[model samples]
Structures are given as structure tokens and as C-alpha cells.
Target: MTTTALGIREYKRGLTDLGNGAYAWLQPDGGWGWSNAGLVVDGDESLLVDTLFDKYLTAEMLGAMQRAEPAAAEIGWLVNTHSNGDHCNGNELVTGAEIVASKACAEEMAHESPAMMAKLMAHAPEMGEVGEFFLHCFGNFAFEGIEQRPPTRTFEGAFDIRVGDKDVHLQQVGPAHTAGDVLAWVPSERLVYTGDILFIEGHPILWAGPVQNWIDACDYIEGLDPALVVPGHGPITDLRGVRAVRDYLVYIRDEARKRYDAGMPVLEAARDISLADYDSWGDAERIAVNTSVLYKEFAGDHGPNDTQALFAMMAQLHKERRG
Candidate 1:
């Protein structure tokens, strides 16, 4: 089945042609490891936006794209929006393509290998509730034995490139969702593929944030005046969706700051923040991480996130919510 929004047709899964030889590979109920990817084709060349969480998922997506459009068979360029494993872990499958990403994204990818995920999953059973929550979030995908393929080309700020006759612009608007986030724009098509910068119909996790950077990133997307916005997760959206994400960031930042001023702990602040406005969005537990990051930003802390502790908080929240 397909749903239409502001003239953009969204599919439950698989590729949806966006006219002008552009297409989006959407995964339904976009959450956790489930991400969306894109293809921009012109003549004999095609540029892929991002890949899925694992080889099997990426292979399926590639197969569908190749069957629908021959140019996908020889993807000339693969642009990873960020360092997140879900976006770049499938790089090894797009053979012969010149992989591209932000310089920070490449560096971040080097430190986060699929092996680390595999090891985490391996020990999940021994970790009790955290393990259960981790499995609930990521257990569906395979993480074992996937080779890491670093970007062959890295850039900072903004870079413009071509896919056949079409001009594709890459803008790095990050240290928001991740250390490096990118937006792929096809000017002629008036379409923008916003990596994790926009998460429609879900609470976005702020893994890296000043919060302002992410809010500005939303403004950057709006400034483009995109006719179609393909988010890193969830359905394809328009300017309305972009604004929604920006508003969420602003609201969370302000609310979290209020609690931080009261000297509330990170997890406590996270749990205390009311998500009544976003009750319809999925993965509400991510408020755990979002608040944690915001609290750090408020304190001027530049330290690395305590991943396990964050997960434990999320697990506790998730369990409490379920009960």
C-alpha cells in the first residue's frame, strides 16, 4: 500500500520513484536500525545516498534498485550521511564505487566497527535487562563478519558533484545528529535526502548535539526549499516534517535545561520530561539519550557518551513504559 502526502507517495517498503530518475528505498516504521536510502540517476550514472544496517539488508535494497534501474548496477558514487553503523556498515557491498563522507564521519567510522556491535550482542545475554533492551532494538540485524570500508573521499563543509547530467550537492551540517551529518541535494529535482538530520514520526536521538547545530541543520534544509525531503528514517516528507523535527529539538533543549538548572540528574531529567506532544512518535525511549546529551551540552562537557549507562536508562524507561 502507498500513502500520499503533499503529492509525495510513500511506500511501505522498497523503492519509490520520485520522478526525475530519483528514488527512495524506504523501510516501514522507521526506527532503530531501520533506515531509508536513496538513488539519483542521470544517464548512465547513479549516486547512492546511504546503505542499510547490514549486508543482507543492503544486498536486498541493491538488488531491488538494480532491477528497477540499470544504472544502479554500477553505482558511481556512494555517499554516507554519517558514521552511524546503520548508514555505512553496508559499504563493502557497493563495489568499485568511490565512497564519500564528511571527514569527521570517516574518522568516527574507523573507531566504530561492526565487530564491536557483534561483541556487544554476544555478551547481551549476560547483561540482563540492558541485554534484553539491546536485543529488542538491534537483534534483528546481523552484525557479524561485516568488513568495514572507510570512505575513499572525505570533505568538510559543502561539496558539489555530478551523477551523469544531474548535479548533486553534499552539505555537511552536523556535530548534530552525529559528529558529521550530511544532506544530499539534487537542485534540479528540488529534492533533499537528509541523513539522520531529519527523523519523521519518531523522537530523534541526539547522539551529538549542541542542539543548536541540529536546529540550524533543520533551518538549512528549509532554506533549500526542498519539494521533497527524504529523511534518514521514516517516510518521505516535505517542509512540514522538517519543521516538526526542528521544533522537537527546541522543545527538548529548553525543557531539559530547566531541569538541569534544578540540578536534576540526566536520566531523571529524561524520565521527567513529558513527551505528551510527541506521543504519536515511535521510539520515545530515545528521550533517555537525548536528555543525557543535552545535559552534557548544558554542563560544557565534551566527554564521550557512556553508551551502556544510556542503554540501561533507556531499558529502564522502556520497561516502565511497557508496564
Candidate 2:
């Protein structure tokens, strides 16, 4: 049977029963359907792994959760897996609850500002159709509405929170995908919410990594053998999904190494490499920047890539692909 795209459908939401008062909202067509946040609730209080990208999106998701397993208002804690706008942007939607995240993620959220995003969007008109098209998909979302509330309670190592009668463990596995990446493990539920650490059937973002650290996270996750692993993006998956990401990492790492050894330029090499195994992965083209980033790490090119340059690189490739 032909597969349906991960979008193009009303985002399916609400909790799937995982036993022990713990449940996860599996967003169908997980690509960009809505932020894949996990919910763990018990008789006394509740805990949210992450929030959606915007108020409208999150509000809808919040309502859905209430419908599936009513009484979400009693939620007491919220944990953001990282600073990526998609994962933590909807903080305002979680009313009356305390928001949480790693210190590094909190710091990264502080680094972004409405003025900066506004400046980027202001030039959208002149960027032509592709630019405007990009804006249309992203610009409608509000950046000004974002209120940067860093995690009130931050921890360097593992932290434990007893959710009513259950034990939910928060592990600090970061500096791999971001400065501070984390995963939520519910012992009783035997489930894991892997933020961007695990991207099933989608192009994994390697923005802040030694790559090997992300690989390590995959290895760590494999050891857990969670029954229902809620990936940062894509459909709910099993351990099989975890292996896909590991294989992608190995594929790209070897491909880039081959090019680097042959003394190929990063950008040109990006276009030339045939990523067949990862071809089905959403935004497979991101392999271009992924290659650039990994090559930079190998060569120690640690110079900062500010917004404009970052935009230019992505925009240029977007234009090329469209043409």
C-alpha cells in the first residue's frame, strides 16, 4: 500500500493508554503535524514532556488531551526537552503549571528574540516566491507572543519527580542535539519521550553535536527498550525506529568521511552524495547542511553561523531544488 504523507490530515491527538496512569498523544503524520509532546498523569498531578510550537496549535492539543483523559488542569509540571522553537515555543499555553527544561535549553530560549525574527521576516517580500512561500509556511506563526521563561528548576545531572504515585526520571542527555537535550523515562509505564534525540522517518537535525553524542543517545535509548517510544517527530514507534536513526548516522558519517578524504568541497560534496538509505527521510536534502556541519567539525571550523548566513544557505538550496 502507498503511504500517506505525514501531514495533509487533521492532526490526530490525545493519549494512547500505556497503563499505570501514563499515556502519550501520538500525533499522526508527525512530520510537522504538531509538536509531539508527551503527557504523564496520575491521580494527584500531571507532567508534560514538551509543548507545541504556537498558542493556537498548543491550545488545540491541550483540548484534545482533556478530551482523551480529562482533568489535565491538575497538571503540575512541564519539561521542555530542548530550546528548539518547535519543542518549547508554546510555553504560554500551559496555564497554572510550572514550566521546566535543562539549563542549557533555558539559556538558548533566552538567546532568541522577537526583534531578531522580525528582522528575518521583514525581508521575506524581496526574497521572491520561494522566500515568500517559506515565509507563508513559517511567518504566520507569532514570535512576538513568545515569552521567554527559562526553566525555574534546572539540574546538571539526573533528576527524579514522583508523579503522584509513579516515578518519572528525567535524564540530561545533551550537548548532542542541543546544548541541553533530555529524555523522559517513566519506569512504571516503560515508555520514553525522546525529544529531538530520536527522529523517526525524518531528517534528524544535527545543529549542536559531535554527532557521536547523538549516536550515543541512540545507543542509550536502544538499551531502554521502551514499549512505546514517542519520537520528537514522526509517528509513535518501537525500538525498530531507534535503529533507523542509528543507521542514518552511520551512513552519513561514512559518506562525509569519504568525501573529506577525497578532498571535496562541502557544499559540492553535499549535492553529489547519493543518500539512498535516507532518501525517504523527510527533508533528506538537509544532508547538505548536515554534511557541512560534520565537515566543519572534522576540520574544526568553529566560527559562528549567524542567522543571515544560515538563511542564505538553506534558501539557496531550497531555490535550487525548486528550479
Assess each prediction's global lDDT (C-alpha) against the native.
0.92, 0.73
Worst 10-residue lDDT window for candidate 1 reads 1-10
> Compared with the true structure, what per-residue lDDT tens digits does model 2 show for residues 238-308?
77888888888878888898999899987777777786767666755467667877887788877644435
lDDT of 1 by residue, 1-323 (tens): 12263245544788888887999999988989999999999999999999999999999999999998999999999999999999989999999999999998998888898999999999998999999998999999999999999999999999899998899999999889999898999999999999999999988999988799999999999999988899999999889999999999999999999999999988888889999999999999999999999999989999999988899999999999888
Task: Looking at model 2, report the run of 10 residues with the lowest lDDT sum.
Answer: 1-10
- Number of the predicted model whose lDDT against the real structure is largest: 1
Model 2: residues >4 Å from true position, as ranges?
1-19, 26-28, 136-140
Q: Report the CA-based lDDT of candidate 2 relative to the real structure.
A: 0.73
TM-score of each: 0.97, 0.88
Can you list the residue pairs that collide in candidate 2?
A: 6-29
